[model samples]
Target: MDAGQIVEPPRILARRSGDGWVLYMDGVEPSYVRRLDGAIERGRVLMEAGKVPGVEHGAVLKIDLGDELNQRVKTSTQATADAHKAQVAAAAELRRTAAALNEHGLTGRDIAHVLGVSPQRVSQLLNDQHARG
Candidate 1:
């Protein structure tokens, strides 16, 4: 099997002893038993029924079943690209605003305060625009 592929066998929940996790199947088929044993041997925390085991909180578990993972990866990449585009747009707008402010004799610090960004960032924007030409 490929990496990140979890063969779904019949699984039962069992609580771990003193924050240890164990998966106790009702009737252990050969395949299921092998996987379960592998999981256990791998030091994976198994949760017994009605037991609170400490899993890594705030961890993002991405289970890709069917085409869902591929679709999600595409969507996420698109979102990241869109966000970067938005930032570039915003930076361009800020440069325009800074130019207008400069034309009106506004200081970089004043422009930064108005734009709610650091004065250093305002300077960088101005410098970047100058560099493009």
Candidate 2:
């Protein structure tokens, strides 16, 4: 395959057959996804070899795996958002704790040692807390 050549994406037909999803591609046998791993593996091999043009890498030929895969994507996205929120909340809590410890006569170096952070970080947190107020 030429590196600069543009390959048109292939049209794929996906359907729920009985108990599993099946993907149909031109010039390729219909593959039973979630049933026979070989079909999925074969699709991957064909795409990698460029025998199947226009198929994106790592894509299951754009076959819709129905609700299960859709839900998984949603759940994964939510998890990522939750992780960010948790990190932000933890940073806010740390800043408040640093300020409280400083008010109790703990120096920036003492707070840094107890909090397992650099003295510079301790100073920054304290300054950030003051600015927020």
Candidate 3:
């Protein structure tokens, strides 16, 4: 290899079709990935195993999976963050509701029954509310 010459990372084309991800690399076997993280992991495994055609062992691999796949991953990540935010908000609301119910003369057991949670959980929520205040 000439000095300063650009070495392109071995490219693997990946796409989600139907239920799974399909991957294609030059001179290597076409493979399918089932999970969301499986395509990148598959590429890494191939690169480390010296299976990406002419690419040597430990060569960096480029996943040229198109914009659609990238968008899907980005959207999924955003959705996860959104879900976490919603979960936090819901927990905060539960704490407030539990405290309010306690002030309205509801016992821990009654609040637990109304919220479909254990009495211990209701007590914990009330404690959390008090701690925050």
Candidate 4:
């Protein structure tokens, strides 16, 4: 195969599946196959002449792996999601606690002290409940 055989390189695509992930690329054209076959034939001849170097890690190309990439992408995404869920849970709990305290004869100021929030915030909570009712 001639070096000028392939006009363009194959495009690669990565996609996630239910089980894991898969990668796809353009199928090899006839010219590309002939090109690769030529390379393989060349390699075969080199091997016949004992020209191949000893197998070693240093012989292959090195690249960045999952560990070396932006590890924060996954971690930060999960952390942000967890934080949002916590914030929602805390808000629901606060509403329940405020209602319970109010029913037990605690004033807005007392509820604020117990909850460590401003009394005005307690007033707003109570007012919201009142408005809803």
Name the candidate that leads on lDDT. Answer: 2
Clashes of each: 9, 0, 0, 0
- Checking candidate 2 for backbone clashes, the offending pairs are none
Candidate 1 per-residue lDDT, tens place, 22-84, comes to 444333321122233344422223322223232222111222233676698789999999999
Cα lDDT for residue 18, model 2? 83
lDDT (CA) for every model shown?
A: 0.56, 0.78, 0.77, 0.55
Residue-by-residue lDDT tens digits, candidate 2, 1-133: 8898876766555666887767777767776666544555656655556567566644444546578987897899899999999999999999999999999999999999999999999999999999999
Off by over 4 Å in 3: 1-64
Candidates in order, TM-scores: namely: 0.47, 0.52, 0.54, 0.46
Which window of ten consecutive residues has the lowest lDDT sum in model 2?
56-65
Residue pairs whose backbone atoms clash in candidate 1: 13-49, 14-47, 14-48, 14-49, 15-48, 15-49, 16-20, 21-46, 22-46
lDDT string, candidate 3, 1-133, tens digits: 6767666656667666678777777656777887556665676576657555435432333454578877897899899999999999999999999999999999999999999999999989999999999
Candidate achieving the largest TM-score:
3
Model 4 lDDT tens row, 1-133: 4755543322323333444333332332211122232333333333334433321111221122256354766688799999999998887678778888999999889999999999999988777666756
Clashes of 4: 0
Clashes of 3: 0
RMSD of each: 12.0, 7.3, 7.4, 17.4
Ranking by lDDT: 2, 3, 1, 4
Scored by Cα lDDT, where does model 3 land? 0.77
